[model samples]
Each structure stands twice: as C-alpha cells, then as structure tokens.
Target: MMRYSWLLSTVAAALLGSPATADEFGDPEAGAKVYSQCKGCHQVGAGATHRIGPHLNGLFGRPAAGLEDFKYSKSFQRAGASGLEWHAETLDAFLENPRSYASGTRMSYRGLKDETDRKNVIAYLRTFSDDPANIPEADPTATPTDHDIDPVILAIQGDPEYGEYLSSECTTCHQASGGDDGIPSIVYWPEDEFVVAMHAYKNKQRKHPVMQMIAGRLNEEEIAALAAYFKNLDN
Candidate 1:
C-alpha cells in the first residue's frame, strides 16, 4: 500500500474565504517578533536544529518534508511527492492553516491568521539561508505592469451559474475545498479581480505553464463566469 493518507483537507482556503495575498509581504523584523509564537515548536537562525519542527534553512523552493533528520508525517511526505514547493504563495497559504493545507499533518499549533505575520515570518525565515538566490528578489504579490490590459474586453461580467458549470475542470487542480496540494485556491475571490488574474495567465503575463494552458482555452466570458462562481462560494 502507498504510504499516503487518503483523507481530504477542507475544500476552502485556510483563512476561510479571505482573499489570496497578491500584495507585498511585511517586514522581516516584524515577522521575527511574530515568530515568537512559533519558537516553542520550531527554530530558525544560526545553528538551528530539529526542534519540535525541522530546521527551516533554505526553505523557499525546497520540497516539503525534505529533511532527513526529522521524520515527517506520511501525509506531508506524500504531499512533497505530489510536488509541493515552498514558494512564497505556497508558504502564505500553508501558514494560514497547516492542517487544511495537508490533512493529517502532525503540526499541532493553530495557523497564523494575520497576513502581515505570515509574510514577515516567511521573510524572516528567508534570512536563514546562506544563498541569496533562494530568496525572492521582488515581491511576488505585485502584478506585472509591462502589459496593457483591455478594459473593453474585461467589461463583461460573468454568469456564476455558467461559470459553475464550467468550473469542473478548474477544480481538478484547484480543489474546491482550497486544499493546497501545491496549487492556489480561487475560492472566495472578488469576481472581477479573479477575471483579471485569469487574463494574466491567458496573456502569458503570469509564469505558470499549466495555468497558461488552462486559461488559454477560456474566453473572457467563461473566465468571468468561473470567477463569479468561485467568488460566491462559502469560505
């Protein structure tokens, strides 16, 4: 049998319908303070070892449950196998709720709900790694300004009912429960903003190839509809 838990996490974002973070993170200094809450279970900075949690050195882009010294929950290891990379957005969602991100994970502390604390903690952790390349240079939340968006094309509002019908394909990766098996949840988003994001994917403004492919097939109306459908979902 596979060493994986078959249990499913909730099909909603960890913050229970809060908007996804598409903005800049908080100060690392502030995060270091917020992380005091985490010190009981985790350790960071120089000579940090495996405490209640694994040392998080060079965590960004590192695969989940990557440490050999610390035994991770089978659920976490399986999640790693499923391609969960610890990028900024991924970290953001997971920090919002660990158990929701990976059901059956052994982590016991409640997730950090403050977006600023989450960003700050991730930023503070970014300082632990020796390699600067492991850290992101610019804020991941900032939308690219290079491309001009079509206001006329975007003017159309989507039909949530039709979008709900079209959303079957989207839920394949985005799991309706907002479970983070390395994918971001679109649940509880602003409809228009969600359309703008999908259009970014369609225009190759966003970098992910899979999203580009998925968004490429959607017309402006379909994108709007799906956005509306998800926007109306209960958190």
Candidate 2:
C-alpha cells in the first residue's frame, strides 16, 4: 500500500509539472525574503554545513535529528526515536510553533504566526532537498473548513485572575513551567492565537476529543481568560 501510494503521488506530481509551481505550496521567491530570519542559524544550498543548527540540505524526508554529527536536544531525539520525519505538513506544524511541536527544541525563534510565511519558507527550503518536484504541495491535516470566530468574542477582555483559577484542569496535562513531555506547552502563547485555537476546538474545526470537550464547556469570556492567563504565564 505504501509503495502504491508513493507511485500515485509521483504520477500526480508529474502531471502537475513540478510541485514548486503550485501556489498552494507557496512562492519560493517570496520565501527567499522570509528565509532571511533563518539564515543566521541554518545554511543550505551548495557547500552548506552545520552551524548553530544543522544545514537544512536534504531536510525533507529526513528523520528528526537525522544528522549524526549534530547534537540534538533530548526532546528532538525522543521525537526522532518515536518515528518523526520531516515533510511539508509536519514542517508546517513545527514552524507554526517550534517549542509546542518539540518542547525542548533548541531553536529559539518564537515561530511564524502567519500561515503564508510558514508555507513560503517550507517551499524555499524544499529547493535544497532532493527531488523537490515530487514533494507534496499541501498539508492534508490542515483544518478542512474555516471557522469564522465572532468579532465580539475575539475582542473580549479576559480576566487573567479568573483564568488562573480555572487553569487547574489545563495544567494537569500542559505544564505551567512550559515543559512539554508529550502535551504541548501552552505558556507564553499570544492571547489572540490562544483564543483562536480554543475556539477552533470548540467549533470542532480542530480535532482533539479532550480539547473539544474542554473548549465546549467554556464560554467566550472564559476562553479569553484562559488565553490571557496562558499568554502571560511565563512572565
């Protein structure tokens, strides 16, 4: 089944000419500009080598912490041990929030909050990998439908004190100190993004049974409070 799927994907890519040309994947030219933020830590293209971070050449299809010479954080090592592989979709998730995806990752960049930036950067990085033409163009796990949150709900001013009181249930899984064993660390997230994520769960636009149930119980103000609390938890 795996071989058959691979063959089908390859054929589809051939039909599409090159995955790079697909706008859904992103514009490499634009990505070049976005990639300036990453150049300091990573090197790519010809003659690239490990620096603060490993050279990103041939990153796609490589397992997490794949470089034998580079020392990776214990969190990344664990992710690799648990069979993590780099691909467009996985990269998108990680780039959206690095610490959340791999709790103890040494990469200090907060993350690209803009979806387009993440896509474009991934597209740019794809150029350094072998067989960029065959790489997938879209994230299959992305939310299938847009969940339009009400403006009023988004604008609500939350009480962080109340959020702290209500966060006991949340802290059970998500550590208060920003440590993520398996569950993602919620500390220090921007309030708006946190609110949006909880709403996504509440609306069932994002999948996760436990999250959905918790979000379902929270009113708009309560969600905002939680967002407010988490955003400043690290502070």
lDDT of model 1 at position 61: 55
Q: Tens digit of lDDT per residue, candidate 2, span 1-235? A: 2223445665776688955234555767788899999999999999999999999998877888999999998868867775667766667767876765665789999988788887788888878877635434422222111234568998999999999988888999989988877777788877877787787668653446787799999999999999889888863
RMSD of each predicted structure: 12.7, 6.8
Each model's lDDT: 0.67, 0.75
Model 1 / residue 161 / CA error / Å: 21
In candidate 1, which residue ranges exceed 4 Å CA deviation? 1-23, 133-235
**Tens digit per residue, CA lDDT, model 1, 82-105:** 666666666775676665456557
Clashing pairs in 1: 11-177, 11-178, 12-177, 12-178
Query: Which lDDT value does model 1 have at 137?
Result: 47
TM-score of each: 0.50, 0.56
Model 1 — which ten-residue stretch has the worst lDDT? Answer: 1-10
